[model samples]
Target: MVISSQKENDVLIKPDKVIKYKNSNIILNISNLSIGYDKKVIAENISFNLKKGELVAIVGVNGIGKSTLLRTIGGFQTKISGSIQIEGKELTTIDTLDLATKVSVVLTEPIASKNMSVKELLALGRQPYTNWLGKLSDEDIAFITKSVSLLELTPFLDKKCYELSDGQLQRVMIARALVQDTSIILLDEPTTHLDLYHKVQILKLLKSIAHKTEKTILFTSHEIELAIQLCDKMLILDGRTNPFEEPCKLIEHKNFETLFPADMISFDANSGSFKIKK
Candidate 1:
């Protein structure tokens, strides 16, 4: 795959602190991406490149197509028209299983399994690498063990999935994705239906994972302030307009507050922070 990277030796460029990649870093490139359902266009002309280990937060009002964007990125939507590439390779050109091995996803909806345990749910992530019958190898077990522990789920390993709280369940889902061992992780409204505290906890957890594990994580969130505080970058959509960026340098260009909140509030450009734009 042909991933692009900014020259680290360039004194003018700030260092990218996203996750570390093996051999060399490959930035994921999404170009002219358009997505839709059977009868309607959800979004179009979307383009961006993500550096390895970067954490991106997407924000848009309800029905603004944020989740649709993540679905397109994860290959879950079939009605997309555009190109997605990782490390210089076109995403559509790769095999589905190969794609699975390269990307993992978590959705906001709770996973339902009347008979599964937390351990089993996490183990399912290794299916892409396992035998046809989904048999676990020693390597799979090792990944599962590490993932659960990272989520602090060791005490609940054998506990039934249905018995866990919403917070615990979210962690289990994340652990499942981690065990999949993919370079890109997509989460669709991960904070949905969460209490305020759990919402903060989950976003914080994602930020920590991006820093410690060096994983490329992109998730949709409605918690605007929280997302801005913890995410390395932000992708924002306003109605039928294009997606604009909130990078470290170009944040003001987005005109963030007025995009969603319809008020004449003001934001300070000096601090590189935001408030309601007046």
Candidate 2:
């Protein structure tokens, strides 16, 4: 069943202006963005302003440029064209270390170091703040303590990173990002390899970070329904074009089914879910 509202209001208009929280900031802005790999354009025309205190999910089916878009904004891939501004400054203008200080990324990739304990892994986040030869002061300890608490990882500090469950490992990774203390945080497929409970937990934690810390967040996830329910907004891609919008409006436009397996499944408006046909 195709999902929709009974109201006859036209489903399309200029998207609403982004809302702001008191004393919050706009941490990421991309205009006419076309991001590519090896000169092939994987995503383009992505324009949006991400306000602080907003959790944004990048939603699209596999191979629809979700990661490409993220890499471009994260400065992992160069934008073939367009402007990306982080904290009202041009993205390319920032030096590498400075850029790293501004944006922290939490990817779904497996942690590379086998020897590191959870505490040691989290210590890497302090790299930007540490002096040469890597020393941690009391302030660093305080920040790491806060991150561990936020992710509820205090008890696992001495545990080896490889020993944790997938969910716990994911939380540890996020704690590492939090210690980085960047204005913007981006994650790609953060829920991959996680169980349903862990998925919800991670999303809730990210949402809390956005609101309580007033940080701008953009994450790419395959959990379409979860994204709709939890995020303040989402960027739905068409071909290479990502149209940034709120979930309710996208539902109102009946654009939900287009994001996934075309004919076999449909969106359920009353239930606010996507379901397969019998």
Candidate 3:
């Protein structure tokens, strides 16, 4: 991956802060990228490179553009400027059909219908590779079966999506992404609305999937403490230099200390968690 050190007046370039990695497995590379609506920039100067088998989290306070950054990277929304390259190809140049095989996205929005069986919902992940008639090949079925087993969804395969609880449905959604078999999986708030135990369970599952399957998994999350424990790397969208590095390095640099109001909560680097001030 190329790391540009050139400085621009309008850009918040941090060549010194950015970590450099020499690996052929790098699939997703974002350099000085900006994301937002027309004429309104939500975040800028974002730079990071993700390699296969890495589970990364994008965390920040609410409205810090974590979700927007995920959408922009997944190609659901437009980027204002800079680069988003998948395997050396620009994101904008790739067409929808071809892009589907490279990146899979899971958003926080509700499904169109929960009446579909869990197995049926997972079958949709292979739609990109299916023929015009939308028939699943043996390979596709095998992929679905493998993902089901990995996510522990076998017991719920015949059950309707509506019958599953929040945690189960979330696992199903992640399983669907795994079934897609894309090189990169982008999830927006994958652990939202879950209790602490379930939240940890889901994050641990994601970390396992990424490592065992060699898929690059990136998710936006509010569970900063859990993310620090489970993620291999993290990108804090502070809207400035947007520091991206390993979890230990981020904590060593005290990035989480300034994430919120100092009067309310403070980061305890010793324990790698945020504690409310008394």
Clashing pairs in 3: none
Q: Model 3 Cα displacement at 220 (Å)?
A: 0.4
User: Highest TM-score, which number?
Assistant: 3
Q: With candidate 3 superimposed using the best TM-score fit, by how many Å does residue 48's alpha carbon deviate from the native?
A: 0.5
Residue 267 in candidate 1 has what lDDT?
Answer: 45
In model 1, state the lDDT of residue 193: 79
How does residue 151 of candidate 3 score in lDDT?
A: 90
TM-score of every model versus the real structure? 0.83, 0.89, 0.92
Evaluation by TM-score, superior candidate among 1 and 2: 2
After superposition, which runs of candidate 1 have C-alpha atoms over 4 Å from their true positions? 1-24, 239-251, 264-278
Candidate 1, residue 100: CA error in Å? 1.0
**Candidate 2 Cα lDDT to native:** 0.82
lDDT score at residue 215, model 2, on the 0-100 scale: 79
Higher-scoring candidate on TM-score, 1 or 3: 3
Q: lDDT for every model?
A: 0.76, 0.82, 0.90
RMSD of every prediction: 6.6, 8.0, 5.4
Residue 263, candidate 1: how far off, in angstroms?
Answer: 3.5
Clash number for model 2?
0
